[model samples]
Target: MNLAARVITELFQPTVTVALLLLFSPAVEPGFPGTAWFGAVAVLFVCVLPLAAVVLLVRLGKVTDHHVSDRRQRAPVLAMAAVSLLAGLCLLLAIDAPRSVIAMMLATVGGVAVLAVISLFWKISGHAGSIAFATAVAVLTLGAPWSPVLLLIPAVCWSRVVLRAHTVAQVVAGAVVGGGVTTLLWWLLLELTVRRA
Candidate 1:
């Protein structure tokens, strides 16, 4: 892979999902003590623990790549990640965190569920899907001013192709699924919680 593609792939690795959620998470709010704690929990549960699970799967010979490059190995890892995300969602709800945070987090979990089902028959590019979802959520939460981030979707799709990790069709499917599903869920939840009278 060329350095540019490699760089883009690295920058948008699945880890970014966690980081972006934390960045946009309600934890940034100043007044709520619970919000700050929820942020920490988000990092630990959404990012740190799930990443540790990936590492453990690698070390245990259960997965062939850091990215779970082998399609066959993805189900167990994705299922575990989904469960972890659901747990994080529950924790946020139990603490009465804002609906936006909960919605974004659910979108993340929902993405994994969608990916898991698709992985059973196809090797969709997780990187492509994740970037698509992230871009959509960032724009949805931050408004049209943040729309430029959508450019990353094509960039990531190209990187996956360049690296030979996924084909053009797989990348395309991932972008559609990731962007479509996440955008729908997030918009619905945010609309219900924020926009509706």
Candidate 2:
């Protein structure tokens, strides 16, 4: 594939997406919520899950003589994501921690969930859906973290498009999937946790 295609694929890939999300989150939202220990957990969930998926796919491909790209096994991928989200939530709730810590944990869970969904869509559609979903969130959320996240979204989308790993449509679709899901989760958490208190 060309450079653009490689960039696109890298951007859309779960590992890359999660890493970028994690990086951006800390960068935009300063101060380590609580113990800073939770950050390690977040990094593990973001990085390990995708790496595991890639390993599984590679092994399965070799053993079964089938082309097992991340897209082909949506169930496992989503399951991993759900597991990570649950883990993050449990950690946050169990800590008897500060509100900031809890909020940060909730945000991480929401973000990872969004990344998983986007990966699934990228496997199927391409980039267009991702971009559309992201754009909608950017417009609706305005000054929220979701909107700021849009900054990274375009770079990721463009990388995928340039690499030709995904068609413009697929890249957009992935953005939509990522942005919409994350925004919804974040909003729900805010309402349930922050507003209720």
Candidate 3:
């Protein structure tokens, strides 16, 4: 049970979830494969490099674990990832990547910023939050058939609690932050883009 919980926790880490989300962003845009590399660029800066930072911090003993179970250790890491996200956002804009992809990046930056602020005072479940955000985005982008993806939120929350990484309330709050923030931001960005068009 413990091993399985750990696997689930690791599987839905923010880095992985964001990578999957970015990689799927092109699909949300009209011209897919053409803008596919934009997703790759996002994954490189927002996911891969930030992940590398966490790994390096773990090696240096700056972080308690790869997951950064210690809330105190999260701010710096989140800040580093924010920088990467910003850089990705700029590059995506400069390259005029698809509106959906750019909006996704912006939404991601918003989510990260929220999590970073919350983590400063509480040990929120980044794992749960990440999964919830992904689920929300999936449902929003794919509609009714994808609504089932919401199930992953509770599963991730259960895994976090089972792993003793976070309290039930913490996990719930994480879900709220993840799903609520991203859904609002992404939807708003897309809406604004459509209006501008």
Candidate 4:
């Protein structure tokens, strides 16, 4: 049970989830010029670089674990990730990435910022939040066909709890913040893009 929970947590960690989402963006909006490059840039800054920071910090003993389960150690990590995210966003804009990809990145930035702020005093389940955000975005972009992804939210939340990483309230809050904020932001961005087009 413990191993299964850990496996799920690691598999759907934020960096992995974000990487998959970006890599899959091309499929969502086909034929956009430089679509593959957009995903590569996003994965580099938002996923690769941030993940490197965490691994380095863990090696340096600044972070107790790769997951950064210690809330006290999360700020610097989140800050580093935010820098990477902002850099990615800027580069994506400069390169004229597709509107759908840009919208997804923007929503990602917002979600990370919110989670960073919330992690200050509370140990939120980042696992739950990340999976929920990914699921929400999948549903929003892929429509009813992808609605089934919603099941991932509770599954991830349960994994977090089973591992004793977070309380029920913390996981629930993570899901709400992750799903709600990203959903609203992604939806609004897509709507605005449509309106302008």
* Cα-based lDDT for every prediction: 0.79, 0.52, 0.86, 0.83
Query: Which 10-residue window in model 4 sums to the lowest lDDT?
Result: 26-35
Q: After superposition, how far is residue 8 of candidate 2 from its true place, in Å?
A: 6.4
Give the runs in model 3 whose Cα sits over 4 Å from its true position. Answer: 194-196
**Model 4, runs deviating above 4 Å:** 30-34
For model 1 the local lDDT of residue 25 reads 67
User: How large is the C-alpha RMSD of every model relative to the true structure?
Assistant: 2.3, 5.6, 1.2, 1.7
In Å, residue 158's CA in model 2 sits off its true spot by: 2.9
Is 3 or 4 the stronger prediction by TM-score? 3
Tens-place lDDT per residue, model 2, 1-197, is 46665555555554544444343332223354434555455656656754666577667763221213346465465566667757765765576544434554565456545555656545533233334343443454355545655565666666666654456776665556555565566556546754576
Q: How many pairs collide in each candidate, listed in order?
A: 0, 30, 0, 0
Query: What ranking emerges by lDDT with the best candidate at the front?
Result: 3, 4, 1, 2
lDDT of 1 by residue, 30-149 (tens): 455556556666667677787899998899988887788899989998888887888887888898877667767776777778989999999998898888878877776678999999
Off by over 4 Å in 2: 4-34, 59-70, 97-151, 195-197
How does residue 150 of candidate 3 score in lDDT? 91
- lDDT string for model 4 (7-35, tens) is 88888888888788877665556575446
TM-scores for the candidates = 0.90, 0.59, 0.95, 0.93
Global fold similarity of model 4 (TM-score): 0.93
Of models 3 and 4, which has the larger lDDT? 3
Residue 103, model 2, lDDT: 51
